[model samples]
Target: MPELLEVEYFRRLAERCAGRTILHIDVPDAHALADGRSPRSLRQAVVGRRIELARRHGKLLVLETDGPALGLRFGMTGGLVVDGELAIDRLLYSPGTFGTAWVRFGIRFDEGELLFHDPRRFGRVSLDPDESRMGPDAMAVTAAELGRALATRGPAPGPALKARLLDQSAIAGIGNLLGDEILWRASLAPSRPARSLAPAELRRLHRHLVATLADLLERGGSHTGDLMAERHLGGRCPKDGSPLERSTVGGRTTWWCPRHQH
Candidate 1:
């Protein structure tokens, strides 16, 4: 899943695409279009307009245009490429699959082109002007705001910390991997209730959340050297040299340093 860092990376790329007039748009995969929006409708909305700016809320990238705004949701395997160069997670992609199954949509300009590539087809291009569907951005929210949101949803919580973290309405932009990473860094078990954390623990979690995001963003949004990286292949904990633990949290495979993360 494309988390906050990944989406922010895309927003930067989309920023370069700003002021470029949309000469054409090719919708090779109709399934990539969000429900209730068609290829023709999307084309008509953006074909002649200029992209004014690009911004992100949560995991959704919004491209503000002279007319309607464009929202991109990169599901599980979605990314953006401009002029044959990968923007976000550039280290993970290769030039071999530019216009293949990975590409769902393409926007052409006079000088270059931008492509939305999603191999799994779970990504989406939406024309919905209403952004009220998403909550506050993860990087933009304060610790106090995060605490209140978690507290409201975690009322009488029991082992739903991971699940609550994945809830966009509660706190946007966190996914399965980020949830586990933050919890591990904070030494908080995902199986523990969110409301169980003390004031100090909440502060620790907030610090870890902000720090982890800053580090990953500095590493181009997908650093393999992260604490919980590659634990799926029986990797050990980076901090304690102990075998990492794996389990299903929020219905997603989660890995953590058992020796260090309580």
Candidate 2:
């Protein structure tokens, strides 16, 4: 499934579509975007009411209707791209809408409840009123906030690092890719105990965490840096000349240079 960056990249597709007065709902309770409610909500709240712009929080992308006030989560296997801009009439709601959807991506939601396309079916979509309700996007969160979250880690650092990062409450949007990015930037072995980091090292790691992500977004690329090597039978990292190594961490394949990353 696509990670956060991919999810965000695709989410932009929703912006290109011409919402011809309305759209259908396919995703679940949280799936405003998945359900067509995101654009609907935006049209009603944003376009109708005339709001300025919107933003994304962690995995949740919110449209600033400000009038209707809504947040959307694309879930896995869900995102948009404006390939066709056609919307048919009341004949009946069908994939035709997607042709007009200004984007051409759909799972053809079947769950009477809502469709969640997680190959592992491990991904989910959610919503909240505002940042106060949904909570802040991790990228916007301050170092102090991150430190407080890390401060409560387990006596051991490795598990602690993984747990805190994986937990959405401590920090939103730090998915598997982000965790590896953090570990890689810190040059600290992912298995290293979270509590074992020296104060200076922790500070540097935290700074790198934010800076690395910023640079990736600035460059508009994957935080993976080289996320694919985790699966490459034999591959070379794009950065260093060292041979890539692959192993499992938290049951997820991880690739890195022992020399480049501690």
Candidate 3:
């Protein structure tokens, strides 16, 4: 799946389309349209408008045009291909090869083209997607913002720490892999209660969260995290010589070093 790092790459690739006028749009799969949008409605939105900029919020990519903004959500296996250049060479769990039949949507510019390729058809395209629902971008989130997001309001323990991290409404751009990596690096347990953290722990969590995202973005993608290799059945922790533990946290597979992450 394309996480924050991968989506950032897609945003960079989309920058190629900036200042280019849309000559045509190819909606080979109407199911790719999101928010109950139809092909005709999509065409009516931005057929001949000029792409002014490419922006990203969490996993959503938005192409600001002279007219309406175009939004893209690359579900699990979707990718961006601009002028035959792929934003990412390959995605984990995605097919190794590219097929023409997988192109769900496309845009023909005056000079080149951009293709939204997704074999599973889980990707979506929308016009003027609502960005207000999402929290702050994970890459730029402040410690205060994170504190507010994780602050417990009642006597309830609240959601698990990992669940809070994975919540796009609380902190945008964090997916399964990044959540585990950040928790592991911060030496925090995934199943810890959201409200259990002290001020110091919150600072540590914020530090690792920002650092992990930056490190992964520089390395390549979310799959390149340090804890990625030890996410399996018999995998051992790279930090200590202890056996890694695996379980379901926040409805997603989670791995952590029981010896170090407390």
Q: Which candidate tops lDDT?
A: 3
User: Per-residue lDDT for 1-262 in model 3, tens only?
Assistant: 8898999999999998999999889999999999878888898889999999999999999999999999999998999899999898877867667788999999999989999999888999999988898999999999999999998576787899999999999998999999999999999999999889999999999999999999999998999998888788899999886899999998999999999998
lDDT of 3: 0.92
Query: In candidate 1, which residue pairs get closer than 3 Å at backbone N, Cα or C atoms, i.e. clash?
Result: none
Let me know the TM-score candidate 3 reaches against the reference structure: 0.98
TM-score for candidate 2: 0.62
TM-score of each: 0.89, 0.62, 0.98
Sort order, TM-score high to low: 3, 1, 2
Clash pairs for candidate 3? none
Which segments of candidate 2 are over 4 A away from where they belong?
7-52, 82-136, 153-158, 227-231, 235-245
RMSD to the true structure for each prediction, in A, is 2.4, 8.5, 1.0
What are the lDDT figures for the candidates, one per model?
0.79, 0.50, 0.92
lDDT of 3 at 192: 96
The sequence of per-residue lDDT tens digits that candidate 1 reaches over residues 148-233 is 76675423665467777787887889877678778877888787776767888888988988888787788666433365455675
Off by over 4 Å in 3: none
* Model 3: how far residue 135 lies from native, Å: 0.9
